[model samples]
Target: MGAGDDAGKSFVTSGFTGTGGASAQPPSPSPPVAPGKVEGPLKSITPTEISKRHILSKIKRGTPSDVKNTVILPHVDAEADLAAIKNNQGKWLGGNKYEVNGRIWGLEGSGAIYPVRGDGLVEMNKLQYEALKGLITHEGDRDAMAKDKRFSRYKFHTTDEDWNVAQGVYDQR
Candidate 1:
């Protein structure tokens, strides 16, 4: 009937406009094509997968014999040190004595004391002894030794004077 009415009627018939009109037609289908050649999928890769792929590429390029350079560390004689520790296992000095089980042992400067058990020894620094003095008593009992809870498993019973000496040694350090 008018220019505005014609424009509205044309818009309703056009497929671009979503109005439900009988004149609206579906879009034409696109031409079919083969999938393109690609090295991999478009999805993201994990760090571990990337690292493994990189390592595999390197291996494919060359073997270990093809390596031009390498580094090696100097060797050390650990057996001698271990032998020394084993030899000094149950040795202690005579200044202060602790009786573990039944045998008495003296505290020594070597930082180790033999327990009355005779089979093994406790190794510790002067600072460790000072810290454990409250937990240990002059009588080395299995319960006291077990309860001491110092980093070192070795425990012994010694006098207050010996403990004071140990503390002094720690202070000097």
Candidate 2:
């Protein structure tokens, strides 16, 4: 039957279903949380962040590099204030598009939030279709990145067929 059917002794259907008139005790209260020493409004940009969308020069691999450096309408209303993301995706060893994003993270101990502009790049490799897919992997994890001051000059090399590694430049202000 339902709960607390003590061999049909008492037809109790409420919470106090004691076998021989014994009441159940409620659970104890939880411990109080410790006070936090440091508080943060931590903000990290993800694909959901759609922060700043810009159309950089999509220079196709050709003789004079067909550059589209002008006439780009900034979608900052739905985006942010980044005019461009210094793209370093040039002609790849394979026939694919590599994307690098220069992002600036706030120094943890510092109270600054200005845009220092650091770019990270990832190759689509004719395979993956996301812009920043292999960026951190191509570059390095956050710790490896933090320890190595040369993150600005960091470059990733993979023999992935559709993934074209670039020999261009990144802009991390």
Candidate 3:
């Protein structure tokens, strides 16, 4: 083609141009998600359900009988102790009243008194237990705990036995 012939030809571009050609419109805003509703391929799960599944999966993996015999029983026992402390809140010594050795004690209820030490190993009474529970159990507490190294294992290994058993399992793994 000659140079003059090229001047009569117009060039076409792939996208929008300011010369009055069609332009792409912004995508319409998606409707806001309702409070509990979720979208996309991923599904939301509750922490309780996740914990249940984790326990179930561990059990399903079939530990050596010796490990189960030795480790499982002690873990269960410690769990029972924790449950007792949690359920019988009355047994806790400090009910906004008593403080001993810089720690609150639950004096009233009848159960083996697991004392809360400065190291955060256990709670002396229900009140202390509840306070610790409040710290790690809620989002606010979890966030605050994440910032401090002292509270790293505050939620786990509350009892010496539980801590030992957890350590054993961890070491074995």
| Best candidate, TM-score | 3
How would the candidate models be sorted by TM-score, starting from the highest?
A: 3, 1, 2
Deviation of model 2 at 151, angstroms: 21
Each candidate's lDDT (Cα)?
Answer: 0.26, 0.22, 0.27
Off by over 4 Å in 1: 1-147, 151-156
TM-score of each: 0.15, 0.15, 0.16
Query: On residues 1-173, what C-alpha lDDT tens digit does candidate 3 reach at each position?
Result: 11112333221111212222111223233343334422211122111111111121132222222211211111122233333333332232323222223323222233323222211122122222222323423323446644555445454534443333233222221
Measured by TM-score, how close is model 1 to the native structure?
Answer: 0.15
Error of 3 at 94 (Å): 5.9
Candidate 3 global CA lDDT score: 0.27
Off by over 4 Å in 2: 1-126, 129-132, 137-159, 165-173
Error of 1 at 55 (Å): 47
Superposed by TM-score, candidate 3 places the C-alpha of residue 147 at a distance from the truth, in angstroms, of 37
Model 1 local distance difference test score: 0.26
Candidate 1 lDDT, tens digit per residue, 71-122? 0001111122222223332222233433322223333344332221111112
Best model per lDDT = 3
Where does candidate 3 have its weakest 10-residue lDDT segment? Answer: 45-54
